[model samples]
Target: MASIALVDDDRNILTSVSIALKSEGFTVRVYSDGETALKALAENPPDLAVLDIKMPRMDGMELLRRLRERTAVPVIFLTSKDDELDEALGLAMGADDYITKPFSQRLLIARIRAILRRTEARAEPEAPDEAQPAAEPIVRGRLSMDPARHRVSWNGQDVVLTVTEFLLLEVLAQRPGFVKTRDQLMDTAYQDDVYVDDRTIDSHIKRLRRKFRAVDPEFKAIETLYGVGYRFAEE
Candidate 1:
């Protein structure tokens, strides 16, 4: 059973979501504020976390920023229905996903399951194949990706990425210099049934670039073409 931590200031949301997640067989932990969640999470990290953007003391954004410094636990932000900026900022700050307020419980559950599935798949070890050789790590310029290990490095420095970001980078780097439309990248990163806006993909790409740049200040492997798509530079 996957464990989930939910941090929100709303009592009703915490209670309702806890019950819903428990009914679905998830081990649920609830925190009424981000500060409490941050401390507990550092001591005992959950499989995934659902965080609300607004709260007393430390808000979700600060909590996420602090968490990203220590862990890569998948995070899904809960924002107000009209808070598009929050959603985008959360994604750019390393959140794996986000859902607006007044969202369907069913939709939230589906999103959680989808993210868990991706993380779980990445954690599982690949079985050896006698007839086929092991897949080689993809190396393009200063970037290197080991798909089986879910590891990425740039110029010998490790770069951590969420499952969504990793999938997007893989798809683009696999065909360097070939522009992949936003739709194509979305289809690759998200489940077929799950729907995400163009901005979501753009935010993830922005985060991806930021992560790579952290390791290499001169990183310019990811190129964006306005109004068209993005491509990995052929080096």
Candidate 2:
């Protein structure tokens, strides 16, 4: 059974979501604030975390920032309805996905399941086959990606990325100098049943670049094409 950590200030949300997730066979852990969640998360991480943006003590943004420093555990944010800024910021902070407030429990569950599925797929090992060759690490300029291990690095320095960000980068780096339209990237990162807008893709790309730049100030492998999409430069 997958374990889930739900961090929110609202008591009702903690109770209701915990019960719902438990009914779905998930081992649910609830935190009423981000500060408490952060400490517990570091000691014992969960399979995934669902965080609320507006909370006393420590906000979700701060919690996510701290979490990303240590663990790449998948995160899903809960934003207030119509809070586009919060949604974008959360995505840029390494959240795998987000659900707006007053969201259907069904939709929230679906999003959680989809992210978990992707995480599991990446960790699952392929069966040995003599004819089927093993997957090789992708190398482009200073970037290196090991799909089998879900690891990425730049200039020999490790860079942590969420599952969605990793998938988006893999698609773009697969074909250097090839532009991956927003629609194509969305399809690659998100499940067909889940819908995410163009802006979401843009935010993930921005975050990806920011991470790479942290390690290499002159990193310019990812290039943007006005009104077209994005591409990994041919190096």
Candidate 3:
């Protein structure tokens, strides 16, 4: 069974979400603040986390910034504010999804299930014993992405990426010479039963390309396949 951690300062929200998740056959651990959640993750990470945006000890954005430094756990943010900047920032920082407060319990549960499904689907493919050596990290000039480490570093300095960005990059890198359709990328990267449009993906890719270019100008080689999707060209 997939185990998840729910972090929110509101005891009532935490209690309700815990009950909802349990009914869906998930094991849940609830925390009242981001501080405890962070400590728990450092101890033993859960498969997924649901975090509230505003908390007393530590806010969700700060927690997210910190989380990106170490792990790639899929997270869904719960925020009371309907600010677009916060939404974009949260996603850019690596959050999988955001739910505004007064959200439907059903919608939250559905989103969690979708995230969990995608997480399971994106698990690394097995390699043959000989192929194990072939699974070495991908280094394109100064850009290096290490699947084994779940880390991306440019100019020998790590670049903080959200879970979605990491997965998108992984999908592209795994297919060195081939372009991936948006649906294919979504299936491989998200792997959850979801439909992620080109815009959502483009924003992530744009950020990634920009970051890479900032570090190494020649890093814009991530080719957009016109009407298709994206490919990390070996060209």
Top of the candidates by lDDT: 2
**Residue range 1-235, candidate 2, lDDT tens digits:** 9999999999999999999889989999999999999999988999999999999999999999999999999999999976767866887688887777887675577678878887887777767673445468999988999986778999999887766788899999999999999999988887636676888799889878888888998999999998999999998
What is the C-alpha lDDT profile of model 1 across 122-179, one tens digit per residue? 6767667634454578999888999767778998988866566788999999999999
What is the alpha-carbon lDDT of model 3 when measured against the actual structure?
0.77
RMSD of each: 5.3, 5.4, 5.8
Estimate the TM-score of every prediction.
Answer: 0.65, 0.66, 0.62
Q: Tell me how far the alpha carbon of residue 120 in candidate 1 is from the true structure, in angstroms, after superposition.
A: 2.7
Indicate the residue-level lDDT of 17 in model 1. 92
Report the C-alpha lDDT of model 3 over 127-224, residue by residue, as the tens digit: 67634343478886656887655579877977666556777887887768788888776665444355556765777688778767766777766889
Tell me the lDDT of model 3 at 6. Answer: 91
Ten residues in sequence with the least summed lDDT for candidate 2: 126-135
What is the C-alpha local distance difference test score of each model?
0.86, 0.87, 0.77
Tell me how many clashing residue pairs each candidate has: 0, 0, 2
Query: C-alpha displacement of 12 in model 1, angstroms?
Result: 4.3
Error of 1 at 8 (Å): 2.0
